[model samples]
Target chain A: MDLSLIIMQLFSGIALAAVLVITALGLTIVFGMLGVVNFAHGALFMIGAYAGLYLASLTGSFWWGLLLAPVLVGAFGMLIEFVLVRRLYGRSIDDPLLLTFGLSYILVEGVRIVFGSDGIPFPTPPQLIGVVDLGVGFFPKYRLFVIALVAVVLLVLWLMLERTRVGLIVRAGARDPQIMRVLGVDIGKVWLAIFGLGVGLAALGGVLAGPMRSVNPEMGTLVLAEAFVVTVIGGLGSIVGAVVAGLMVGICISMVALFAPEMATIVMFALMAAVLLVRPQGLFGLKGRA
Target chain B: MPVYETKSRPAGLSRRKAMMAMSAGVAALAMPRLGRAADDTIRIGFPTPLTGPFAAEARDQVKCAELAVKLVNDKGGIGGRKVELLVRDDKLNAGEAATRTLELIEKDKVHAVVGALSSAVQLAVNEVTRARGVIYVSISQSDTINEVKDFSKFTFHEALNPHMTTAAVARQTLKKGMKVAHLVADYAYGHEMLRGFKRAQASIGAESVGEILHPFGAADYSTFMPRLMSMRPDVLCISNFGRDQANAIKQAVDFGIKQQMKIVVPVILHNQRLAVGADVFEGVVGGANYYWGLETQNKTAAEFNKAFRTANGGAIPTDYGAYGYSGVGSLLQAMQVAGGTDTEKVVAALEGLQYDLTKGPQHYRKCDHQSVQSVLVLESKKKSAMANENDLFAIVANDPGADEMLRSCSELGHAT
Candidate 1:
């Protein structure tokens, strides 16, 4: 491979990794904090894509879709948490898992019914249509924008989890909700907020991904699988682990695609399996977290 | 308030009844009639992907089938039996298609089965219908369908196989000095397409610089874009259908690959053109099994086009639409010619049967049962040049059905 080609592949991998990081972050947070596997997370992501597509078509502005889709999806997530997920909090894990699994199907089918089965064309805006010539080679400007936007989102997320009083409470809650409750923290409110935030993040990822890919009902299926793999490899609840594993998985897939396109998707699962074999709790997972 | 509500009961009941009637009307419009039992009617089973990735195309197909059935019914039933089409949604799954084939054959007891958009589903359905000696007419293009192992006396393909379409497109596009890179969907259909293209390239003395196989429904092409750029082929051949085709073409445009090399799609769909938009497809040369623009060239096709547009809110018919129209028409014609709906008789009738539909004249070959029809190589017009939304293609090359373009009988392993 030429040097410039390798450089281009690296940037492409990073752009892909950026989307993975944002997608997996939400799954990691929800699973890490709530100890509930939201199978509908993928469906929520798809809803976000549809929401963004519809809004963009209606408003003729991708920015408005980006801003509002996540907010709308997040609000819906809160409602879901309050009405369904809240009751299953102390129940067996299977309860939430089964409930969410069913919800995922409903959401996917509902979207298919409303939007039909064809992939809605979510074209990249004219401003972001061209390529940017890096020193090595040209890269898609929209993809570069995706990477930058995700980086900004991750930075803001890091600040939220590290700096604010609420962030401290949320982090502590993820570690020990019972202890936090005993320490006079409002655990219910914390759970709702975190769940909403997690869902919002997934939707944001969807909005960013819509222009780059076909926005359809089944669009989230691949994302959901990738997000789970990233979450598991990164260590279930570790934000840093998600960020690291996401980039690693992205680069691994991209580089492998350059050589063996068939193995690109399979490589991620192999990486996750390898990580599990070496460290049972995942790379960033706490001892008892798994 | 409840004690005095009795006087308004009639008004409230009527109002509720009115709401119910309105809701029922909307529901009726929403649900497409799959089948209806009519006195003394010949029933035919039609299975297509009514949901999933191919749903949009399936709608066009079903519309064409409906139109064909309507046309037959209007002229008094074929052999005095009203042609009733029983439609089933296969969901693009092979298992579902097989199950539905059995359901349509056994439970519904239809005289014949028509329509399959996916090659995988078509093959599965073929197996089911073949075993039962049920007449099967496929509208999907799959070279393997005609292979002796898969071939059956009862099966007839209405759609042109990959060999025919690719050979036609390649003959028109490939030249002595052209360098081609192939981005094919990694599947049976893609494999057949690549083989056909390679054969064409070899004949033309064109070099095959690179070939990349991407998984079906792959959204991003960035991973392969850099390598393709480096290879710098004169043309990029995309061998994918529907959503995959649209996504790949759009991404190629975004990466400026189109500027560097000419892109040729062997088989393009109606929805795909609409999805990718005319701007991206500008100056691209491709081939279509059918295009609504052909209505102007053929009279029968024009009638179907006008009927389809009237039914579908002025949307022009796609190749899938034409497939459904012609596939159903051929089935009926076979039955009409045979004078009955016996599987063996219909098969005999369909063999070497020439007919005219939305497209011009076409015939099913006696050897492989694959349709012999004109392969249209289209040069996409600019957005400004298009008179209507569906007016995307300008027929640049019309390759007549040639025996050489089709796979030899020996190649398909069909017993002489």
Candidate 2:
């Protein structure tokens, strides 16, 4: 294989990995603290993309739409928590999954009605619209921008989770919600906030992803299953694990595609199986959670 | 909400009467005649996607189907039987389509059934039609539908298989001295098309430089743009459909690809000329089985277009409109030819039939049950800013109605 071609493949792999990282990171925070596996995260991604596109059309600025879309989708997440998801808390594991399963349909259908069933135009921002020639090879600017943007967002999320007061409260609550509640910490409010915060992360990922993927109502549904596969492979609830595993999965798939194009999809599932066999809880999962 | 699946029908007497008696016991018995007799009304059931990802295309198809019915009824009912449409929203998913098909077939007991717009949907409904023995005509062009292992005796299609266009285009390209090409296909449908395109190219002693795979909703073409430009083939044959075609075209232009290469797109992006400004897609060549812009004195085309514009307020792509038109028109014509709504007879008639359509003339081959119709070769003409339309494709060549590439009935996986 040519060295330049190898470098090109890596470029493509890393760009794809950025998307996976953003998706898995959002899933990780929600699972880590709340113990609620929100199956509807994928639908939220689709909604966020559509919302971004719609806003862009209305405002005539893709940049403005990108910024506002996440906020709007985040608010929508809070509403979901308050109205539907709140009731699922403190119940059996299957309740939230089942409720979210039904909610996915509703969300997809609702989006279909709002945006039309066809995929919407969420054009690349003018700043990142064309391909930029790296010294070695040409790379799509939007993809490089995606890789950089996701890296920044990941850094910010890490800082907020590790350094901020609210982040401390969230980590503490995840470890000892009972103790925090005994200390009059308004545990329910914290749970609501945590849930909203997790979903907001997903919405944010969606907004960033609008230009990369089409904003179709069912687009999220396809990715949701894949994200679950990633979550299981990465070790549930581990942000660092999710990011690392996302890149690992992306590289593995790309490398496999060089030889057998059809097996690209199967490679991810096969890798997940191998990971599960090696460490049932995943690469970074705690034994108790598994 | 009804959850009408394709299996709900039990091959009841209504269906039996519909298959046998022309207008006697079924209608006079007042047993809620499912299939209306002549002068009464011929109900054509449309199991379509009205609440899912395919809603836009499916909705447009429904309107076109409705318009086709109106045109037929208005110009004079088909063999004196008024065309009545029974439409149900199938949500565009395969499982739901299967379920809804049964409900429509059983509850409505339509004289004949028009199926889902997607090839996946058609595959699912094909099973139901085979089982219930209901005459089914789908608008989907998935060639596999005709060759399914268990061919449905009752199902027929007005939509030409992807193979036909692929083979036709490849032969044309080879004849035009464009040997080396690049293939950018839109996954499954694109893959199916590529199958035929590759086969055709091999026969002509030519091959593609490389193939590029893309998921259906891919928005950025900058990645594929370089690969296409680098390959620099004589022709860039893209196997994209619908909105993706327009997006790919824009991105290709941005990359300055079309400036150097002859671009060929299969499956005209219906209403794409209206979506992206025409100036962007000008000079590009694409193929279509039907073009609304074709000069035709047929009242059917005029009425259908008028009603569609009144309702949709947008240009209707020939794919959805023509599919719907042929689906209803072909079935009604077959029924008229058979002198009754007999599923077996209509199926037989549809197997090897010829009819004058909104387009000049068409022939449905018995071999693969594929439509052998004129393939419109159109080149995007430059548009003036004062115009209201998005594209003006200058008719480059009128490939005469000929033998469309087809799978032999037995070689095909079709089961009745």
Candidate 3:
């Protein structure tokens, strides 16, 4: 491959990594701290896209949609946590997994019933519609925006987790929920907030992805599978791991797809399998805490 | 893959005879309600994807089917029996499609079945409807459905198959000695499309540069875009559908592949144009089974378009909805000629059938039961040139169902 081709593919891989990282962040955080599988993560992501699309349509601005979709979806996520997921927090992992799986189906079908099955056009803003020449070759301006936006999100998330009191509590909860509970921090409320945060992050990713993809009902399915792969390969509950793994998976798939397009989807699973064979707890997973 | 199983294809067309015997016995036992006398209503079962990836197209199909039923019933019904539509959500699942086909044939006792959107779903339904000797009018585009090995006496495909569509597209667009690279979806439909293009290219003298079989629903095509751009082919033939097509188009534009090569979409869907933007599709030549813009040119198309728009709250219908309308209309025409819902008589009546619908004249090719109609070759105008909401494609060529546009029965593996 030529130098320009390599540069373009690497850039594309970075754009893909942006989506994968944002998408997996929510699932990883929820699974890491609450031990809830959050199978509805994908559905939440789809709902976010729809929400953003509708908001963009109503306001006639992609900016407003970006500003509001996450908050709206996050609030909705909290509602779901309060109503459905709250009861099964301390229960067997199977119960939450099964419940969220059902939720995922319900959300997908519900969207289909209401909005119909066709994908609505989510256009990139005119300002971001063209290409950006990067000394060597042209790249999509929208993809560059996606990369920047994801970086800001990751940075904000890092600061929130590392610099804030709530972030410390969350890290503590992930390490030992019983200790946090014993310390009189209403664990239930913390779980609810964390769930909402995770769901909101997924929605944010969905909104970001909307312009780059066809926002249909099943749009979430592909991303959901990829997020799961990212989570597993990165380490189940590690944010740092999700970020690292997301980039790795993205670059690997991008490089492979360049040579073997047929193996792009399968390669992620293969990567996950290889990672598991080498490190059962994932690259950043705690010992005995799959 | 069990979800895609049909009785005639239990082990992928092997053990066909044994499975047919088993299916027939089961159908005989389950179809106790088949003895219902010619009732006050004629039921047509429509199994479509109401909750899957193709749900949007399926909804349009269901609407078109309902409109057809309304038109027939409004005309005092076929032989004074009101047409009742038994619509079921196939969910685009092959297993579910089989079950629904059986349910419609047995319990609901639909006089005939119509409306399967997906190739896989239709293939699965074909096995059951064929075994039960029930008439199945398919709107899917699978060439295999009409093949002699896969054919059933009772099945009729109303939409253009991959070969037909690609042949029309290639003839309209490809010039001699043009370099072509195919970014085909890695699936049966995509393979069929590539085969059709290669077949057409053979006659036209177009040179094949390279081909990439990308996974369907791939999240990104950045890698493929640069590699494809590197080949520097004259034309990039995209043989994918739905979001994959849209995603590829968006990314291709992002990667500046559009500036390097001409992008040719064999099957340009309405939703795709909107998703990828009209600007991206500008000046690109392609073909589709139908487009609502035809209403301005053809009287029948005009009437259907007006009625559909009114019914759908100003939303114009696309070629997909055209399939649903024509499929049901053709089935009803056969029933009218047969003068009853008797399966054998209806089948015989439809053997050499011709009908005029949205397009001028269309007919079922007697050999493979594939619908032969004019494929509309269109060029997407610039965004600024779009006159109205549905004014997207500028019809450049209305290639009729000539000998070259359609493959021979032997070529389609349906030799008598």
What DockQ, between 0 and 1, does each candidate earn?
0.48, 0.26, 0.52
TM-score of 3: 0.91
C-alpha lDDT of residue A251 in model 1: 93
Candidate 1 segments whose C-alpha is farther than 4 A from its true place? B1-40
For candidate 3, what is the lDDT?
Answer: 0.85
Ranking by DockQ: 3, 1, 2
Q: Model 2, range B220-283, lDDT digits (tens) per residue?
A: 4444555555566777777766656766776676555666677777665556654455655677
Index of the highest-TM-score prediction: 1
CAPRI-style grade of the A/B interface in model 2: acceptable
**What fraction of correct interface contacts does each candidate retain?**
0.54, 0.12, 0.75
Q: Which is superior by DockQ, 2 or 3?
A: 3
Model 3 stretches with alpha carbons more than 4 Å out? A181-189, B1-40, B310-315, B413-416
On lDDT, the stronger of 2 and 3 is 3
Relative to the real complex, the DockQ score for model 2 comes to: 0.26
Model 3 docking grade? medium
Better of 1 and 2 by TM-score: 1
TM-score of each: 0.92, 0.83, 0.91
CA shift of B58, model 3, Å:
1.1
